[model samples]
Target: MTAATQTPMLAARNLSCVRGTQTLFTDLSLQLDAGQWLYLQGENGAGKTSLLRILAGLALPAAGSVHWQAQPISNQRSEYHADMLYLGHHASLKEDLTLTENLRSLIAMDGLKVSDAAIQDALTRMGLAKRQHLPARVLSAGQKRRGLLVRLLLRPAKLWLLDEPFNALDANAIVDLQECLKAHLKDGGMIVLTSHQTPDLGSDTAGFVLSLSRGRA
Candidate 1:
């Protein structure tokens, strides 16, 4: 395709967000292609999560538009969402369900066809091999986060939108996450994430940072 007609993997143009009387950001734009990641950085209450929600199609921007493969996200909600995965800061788990059961159900909710063996392997890789049978209520915060991260192993989404993915992670878990991210980028996946801690996706991955402050980015 010619350069002028080429579509970006993801693009946000002149986005504006307002909560109550406060305008969090205005006229912000971003573009990401395969093998690239964008990091969202800001202080407390800078609308990082709000911006992520907008990009995920969970919330509406006050102005401007978001496009997936050059189509407005609102116009292609299902197709766009099918290729995107959004994970909030908190782990979404059923307190009464075991980690294994929770992972199974979550994958099912996405309509993914993953085998039990794959789930087991992902759990083991996340360092929850022994704890997979334990209820989420009994696991530590870090373990719960790891359980949620197992989706990254099973889901084949082209774009990943994560909010505070590194929260509650230990040193080893952090390293593991970095490796996972590196692999995702290597496979030509796009990622947008909000985090207080800077991510080290090694030296090869192309990563950019968008710093958000009150009413601007």
Candidate 2:
């Protein structure tokens, strides 16, 4: 008998993007399976962020489709979103809300129920224990980014779509996030992230890189 092939957790086929008159990319395809990471690399205006947005269902592709579990994402928006987490380049936090409150709101918006204690723990892990109760308006850029990253631990998602997750992070925070990514991959999660700088996932980790400059996978 022939061996059984595993279905990818996330897949994009022949995706094309256009912003006004400029064509960012075309015929782009990629697959991400459990325990794997796809690092997207390209220069500015290369559509790395656009492609990530398309995968997250925040925007549609000009051509082709994105699939989750081999099913077109358009057919199962709720389920797909529940299992995927997308953090864009910005902090996207409400300045009026405390860091803890912002995180709780995001969790509630996602329709996932996590305990207050769990949320606190995630924040603590992100090194925001002391500042968790402070309003986001007063936190530094790095603090806001760290607070946003707390969702990684609290979310029950299997796929992560992050754009420049390392931005504004200090050296220690970057290492902490790298550890978090490694831990997620260890547990059979999939990740697709765009970063201008190459991510250090250790010397032995298995992953792939797709450059938007090539215009296709």
Tens digits of per-residue lDDT, candidate 1, 1-217, equal: 1123367889889999999999999999888988999999999999999999999999999999999999999999889988999999878999999998998888888787789999999999999999988899999999999999998988889999999999999999999999999999999998999988999998888888889987778
RMSD of 1: 2.3
User: Cα deviation in Å at residue 141, candidate 1?
Assistant: 0.4
How close is every model to the real structure, measured as TM-score?
A: 0.96, 0.95
Pairs in steric clash, model 2: none
lDDT (Cα atoms) of all candidates against the true structure: 0.91, 0.89
* TM-score, predicted candidate 2 vs. hidden true structure: 0.95
The top-ranked prediction according to TM-score is 1
lDDT of 2 by residue, 77-107 (tens): 9999889999998898999999889988888
Report the backbone clash tally of model 1.
Answer: 0
Worst 10 residues of 1 by lDDT: 1-10
What residue runs in model 1 are displaced by over 4 Å at the alpha carbon? 1-5
